[model samples]
Target: MRKEQRVKKNKEFQEIFKKGTSFANRQFVLYSLKQEEAQPFRIGISVSKKIGNAVCRNRIKRYIRQAFLELREDVQDNHDYLIIARKPAADMDFHEVKSSITHVLKRGKVLKKTSYGKNDRKK
Candidate 1:
């Protein structure tokens, strides 16, 4: 995650945990909250010690970062996003993590619906 997106404190995490909306799949839980300022979306990726040792946690964080790198375009506006890696996420390969993030984005309505909606079909 970028420097702006990283929620490096106990207080910010607490605020989001208390107020942000959350959704989860097998690999990750996504927490989101809106920001008043007009900046692009920001993100935080968390991998706890319960999930693994330092090396393992680093690997998982890397995968999460890669997923976010690919997904930034879709998610990079309007809200703040946090991705908490599950134990399963640490063990899985990159593909699984990517798919999980995509699912979370769709569930969170971060992915835009196509313009070709039912009304557009009439044209």
Candidate 2:
């Protein structure tokens, strides 16, 4: 994600946490706040020290960012999203992280619905 697309300031994180509606699964928590004007969506990721050392924490954050990048076209614009990693997330691979994030976003209704044809089915 680009710097302009990331929510890096503490103030912005606080605002999103305060005003956003949250959704969660076992591995992650998602907070989403809709903006009044049309703008590109921005994302903030938080993984606490309690979860792991710097390397592990950074890995989780990277996974979350990659998930969002892949889901960008399906995610709603004009919103800010903050993702907080839970303990279980530290052990997950990239695909697992993406799946967990997708579940939370769907529950929050922030992900756009896409029609799947027979070919799109996994089996």
Candidate 3:
């Protein structure tokens, strides 16, 4: 995850929380807000003490960053996304976390669909 692709400032997070649309599942909650100008995607991950200790929280953040990196192309650019991990997320593995975030992004309509539908089977 690049620094430029991260939502690091406190004010930035607050603005997104105030203006963003949110979606959630058992594992995580996603808040997305479109930016005014064209820019790269900025992502933030939140895992509080209620979820775990420092090591556990950091692990979850890493998983989220990796998941976001994988899904970067599908994700809408010029937006800020905040991912808040739930208690169940602490027990989940990388794949689970990836699925969880993708689900939320789909529900939030932030993940762009391919023009060629899934039914177009490869020869």
Model 3 per-residue lDDT tens digits across residues 1-123: 999999989999998899999999999999999998999899998899999999899999999999889788788898999999999999989988887887788889887787222322432
Candidate 1: tens digits of C-alpha lDDT, residues 1-123: 568766677777778788899998888899998888898777777888999899999998888888777666666476777889887877788877777788887888776565113222454
Q: Go through the candidates in order and give each one's C-alpha lDDT.
A: 0.78, 0.90, 0.87
Best by lDDT: 2
**How does each model score on TM-score?**
0.84, 0.93, 0.92
Tens-place lDDT digits, model 2, residues 28-80: 99999999998999999999999999999999998999988878888899999
Q: Summing lDDT over every window of 10 consecutive residues in candidate 3, give the lowest-scoring window.
A: 114-123
- The per-residue C-alpha lDDT of model 1 at residue 38 equals 93
| Model 3 stretches with alpha carbons more than 4 Å out | 115-123
Determine the C-alpha RMSD for candidate 3 after optimal superposition of all C-alphas: 3.0
Q: Distance (Å) between predicted and true CA of 43, model 3?
A: 0.2
Tell me how far the alpha carbon of residue 116 in candidate 2 is from the true structure, in angstroms, after superposition.
Answer: 7.7
> Ten-residue segment with the worst summed lDDT in candidate 2?
114-123
- For candidate 1, the per-residue lDDT at 113 reads 67
Better of 2 and 3 by TM-score: 2
* Local error of candidate 1 at residue 15 (angstroms): 1.3
After superposing candidate 1, which stretches have Cα over 4 Å from the reference?
115-123
